[model samples]
Target: LDFSIDELAGNVATGADTLSIALCKVSAPTKEPWLTLSYDEWICVLKGRVLVHHAEGTLEAKAGETIFVSKGERFRPEFPDAGTEYLPVCLPAFRPDRCIREDESDATVGQQVNDMHAKLQVAEVLYHMCSKEDWEKSKADNAAYFPPMFDKDGFTHATSVPSLLLTVANNFYQS
Candidate 1:
């Protein structure tokens, strides 16, 4: 899959219960760190390079190299130059709610840090159903645009918990 450096947007390439593959792009330097609370991630560089700063130390990854960030490890990724593109394969998929931005207030971070363990223990797995054809299309195009209906409705649909996953998949997708 190919992408223009100007596209800073990211999208899920494909996913399953335990992991998800994502195509990520950064057009400009990031101003803050990003904390992934729910899953570990490995960023494989496809073009250009990025400096990954983690609790232990900082490392630079060039094209063809990769970096791993453990779950709960706060890290910041800085794109040294333009045309930075990478693939982040995340364990347990990626959810917006589980991703904490660095701009969050101190109080919020403190509370989340305090409740981290408890939250992790009871975290439920949510699922989103999609067609195999659509997944293949995304893989081929190197872009995963929102489902067509989402443009009309302005929202993506998802199953809230594991229990509903099978029923929803069976009802909507034949293959």
Candidate 2:
């Protein structure tokens, strides 16, 4: 590959799954295949230039310039100038699996994105470590569960990711 991408802020890089920032460096000429992205992309150029070909026309951006491409738009990115450096910011983060190529059915990706949105609407389970006695009390009262330290801390801690449950519990609730 003539290009290299380094993620600055993202799920794997900084755990910010809602957004992504990546530094892309193109050292040689290359024109990627047409594809429709599942997430919006905003690019800012630092060196050289970039040309994005889409159905409407071609969008060009030179050094010190920027370009915006909406998601679900069929487009191809070309780096005609060597040593091109740019930063791409994406909403909802950019994932390789969400990049649907022109050869691939657009409907399939649409449905997948839709299903993902639906799943998100289903609700996420928040993990809160507490004593079995406290848990039973909450279930019996059918109200919010408050820890004994609630009066001291005036706050309740919770995590949406299940993996962090143990780490948080060990660090804060270690007996």
Candidate 3:
């Protein structure tokens, strides 16, 4: 697909049940007032840093960090130090039908970014790597694929393993 920068765009991802993927480049002195409703967002910081002002708190995200912005939250993301490049994923997908934007005057001011879940960043990476293709394909096929909420060891009945050799081999190779 082709990509273009629109002068009229809010520089934010807002949509519903629709998945929008874009490699965004955010620069300093850029703060856009925006809000979303139909879906939540999981933003992965690939380069530089950016700040997100939300109802719960404000946060600063640098390279190698990921942030989740829930739906219906009044938020405005900006880059104060240099610029940043990142990948943003919207749950259920970002559709214009779900986004709710506030007036530019109501945007958050001088807020500090505070992330509560940074460790989940690793899991997000693994999850996307494993399911990104499936997600992309499932969207086209009209199928649904969601990750399990709990590990089998914690919630499911135990099953006997026919062979521990494969497990050992896989573990050694992974390590």
Candidate 4:
């Protein structure tokens, strides 16, 4: 489903338990305001420059910058003086019950931190979901656009042969 922060806050149709993935194309000169999520979110910038602001700090993300946002944390993406695009996946489907709108004096601080960690983990998982070869190819092609530490060493260290096989089979069948 296509989405922008505006559509999300507006009276648009949304699913409760359904997960949604979208490629967001942020136009030049656009900086979305701070917004909170109901479900965990994974964000990976695919084009241009993007800026993410959270309680932890501001993360400047480019093509290879992957980010995770836990449910209920007040966060948002800004263009940072350049247009950008991103891929975002929402798990447990972004239901209203899962989101708490931004407030200056919210009480749920600890939960937000946990959620942020969860979101980042999920983003890392998705980043490596593609085949190692494919991942490497993209990494090379976009080396200039990627962060300095962009490498597939982590994938090699983390994935077992059986796990990779399962992932490949699942992706093949699903596709």
- Which is better, 2 or 4, measured by lDDT? 2
Which pairs of residues have clashing backbones in candidate 2? none
In terms of lDDT, model 3 sits at 0.52
RMSD of each: 15.2, 7.9, 14.6, 15.3
- Top candidate on lDDT is 2
Against the true structure, candidate 1 reaches a TM-score of 0.50
| Cα lDDT tens digits for candidate 4, 63-175 | 88788888778886667544567777777554334565543453233243234334222222322234566668767888523322247422222222334555644653352
Clashes of 4: 3
Given candidate 4, what's the lDDT at residue 31?
50
**Model 2 alpha-carbon miss at residue 9, Å:** 1.0
- CA lDDT, every model vs. true structure: 0.63, 0.76, 0.52, 0.54
- Model 3 residue runs over 4 Å out of place are 1-18, 105-175
Q: 71 in model 4: Cα distance from truth in Å?
A: 1.4
For model 2, how does the per-residue alpha-carbon lDDT over 1-175 read when each residue is reduced to its tens digit?
5777777886556654578887888878766668788999998999999999989899999999999989888898888998999998989786666677654333443343334334232126778988899899899999988888789978776666678778867777657
The TM-score-based order of candidates, best leading, equals 2, 1, 3, 4
What's model 4's lDDT at 69?
84
Candidate 4, residue 86: the lDDT equals: 76
Worst lDDT run of 10 residues, candidate 3, spans 112-121
